[model samples]
Target: MAALAPTAQAGQGDESRLPKAHSWRQWLDREAWRKAIIAIPYLWLLFFFIAPFLIVLAISAGTSQVGIPPVIWKDTFPFGTFDNYVFLTQDDIYWQGYLNSLRNAAISTFFALLIGYPMALGIARASSTWRNVLLLLVILPFWTSFLLRVYAWIGLLGNTSWFNRGLTSILATFFPFWVTGDHIQMMNTNFAVVLGIVYSYLPFMILPLYATLEKLDRTLDEAAMDLGSKPWEVFKDITLPLSLPGIIAGAMLVFIPATGEYVIPSLMGRGDSPMIGRVLADEFFQNRDWPVASAVAVALLAVLVIPIMIYNFFQAREARRGST
Candidate 1:
């Protein structure tokens, strides 16, 4: 009886040592860890993204000068003048750059969508082993440096290059009247710029589309076919509707960066059709007009952000509807 009593007391002691029902403090502690995790990205954005933009906005409102940093901030609060922003309207080049950027980005995004949709659909429909292989092939170009790829395009489009030579040969054979002895002027044109953007941004378009399509319920497609809907009708009604999110995601991914792209346009575009990015570069680097460059950068962000915010609003609404 004495030994049994000690064992019972020991068992009670062990039970007491084990964790009890979580208290409010424990619950709060558990949530603190989650809050910490959530805070990391917000803190990063605060320091890196939002802070830099605020600095740029401040600089944009400043005066242009011949010194290092180039911007002269106001001594008083509000920190600078609105003259630089006003200049964006008065200066035809800056406004024209914005228009050219929008046009080029829109065209490039359309072509990227056209090319990428089929590739993404094919990947989604492929056997698992082949899907991975195909995806690898799509992303293989990224293994090499982006600059090298653009430079290779420069070589390909050059007058004496093999691509141009082959193209010229085909033209000469097919339509002798259109073919001149002079090489095809593929380099330093909007065609090259569009081509470069389409090629570079195509993967961005494909990956998101593939992700969405892969997640889609193929049973819905099969059911639609069973109901006597034609394959094209099924695609239009079932597949395309479900894939709109991916389409928007891919388009934004390609379009946003393409709008602000500097390297592709600089390497491939004519001087007359400078994109907003190139204008920003020339203003800051060549012309040493920091105020104007900062204003252009801020305006470009403002223009791009409106569409993004709209997309976010729609996406959130859709998510809520789906959850319900």
Candidate 2:
């Protein structure tokens, strides 16, 4: 009985060491880890995106000076005059730059969507083995240097390049009296900028669309077909509605960056019609007008952020509806 009592007491001691009905400790530990994982992306945006934007906003409000940095030296605070923004309004070039950027970005995004939708649909409908190959093909250009790709286009679109020569031959063969020149003039035009943007950002459009289309319930499609619905009807009613999210996502991804793109515009665009990105570059580097560049950047951000906020709002509402 004495030995049995000691064993019973030892069992009680072990039970005491284990957690009781208050299991919140383990729950807290799990919640902590999950929250930490979720916080990583938010923290990254705060440090990299938001922080830099705030710094630029401060600089935009400051006065420009002749110095090493070329911006005013205000250490204690960041509040400054709105002279830079006023100056921006006084010139037509800044307004023109914004308009050109938006116009080019919109046109490029439209073309990308026009081309990408069919490609994405094909990939989504393809066999598993072929889908991967198609996706890889779509992204093959990214494997090469972006600058090289743009430069290659520059050669192809040049006045005397083979592409232009062959195009000229075709035109002359079809319409011999159209006064065809030696080669077409396609370079140093908005067309070239649009072409480069579409080529570079098409993958962004395709991947999102593929993801959305691939996940659509095939049974819905089959059921519609069973009900004597045609393929076009099924696609319009089922596929298009379901894929709107991906469409919006891809559009934002392509449009936002393309609006501020510097490389393609600077490399392929005419000097007379500079995009906002080129204007910003010239303001900062060539003109050494840091305050004005910062203001332009801040204005661009203001224009882009409104659409993003609207998107997020609609997305959050949809998520809540779905959850319910």
- Full-model lDDT for every candidate: 0.93, 0.92
Residue 31 alpha-carbon offset, candidate 2, angstroms: 3.2
User: Over the stretch 109-157, how does candidate 2's per-residue lDDT look in tens digits?
Assistant: 9999999999999999999999999999999998999999999999999
Q: Quickly count the clashes in candidate 1.
A: 0
Q: Compared with the true structure, what per-residue lDDT tens digits does model 1 show for residues 1-324?
A: 777887777878689765667787786779878999999999999999999999999888999877776778888887779998889999899899999899999999999999999899999999999999999999999999999999999999999998999999889888899897747999989889999999999999999999999999999999999999999999999999999989999999999999999999999998987999999999988999888889999999999999789979997999999999
How far does residue 191 in candidate 2 sit from its true spot (Å)?
0.6
Candidate 1: clashing pairs of residues: none
- Candidate 2 C-alpha error for residue 97, in Å: 0.7
> In model 1, which runs have C-alpha deviations exceeding 4 angstroms?
1-15, 20-29, 314-324
For TM-score, the strongest prediction is 1
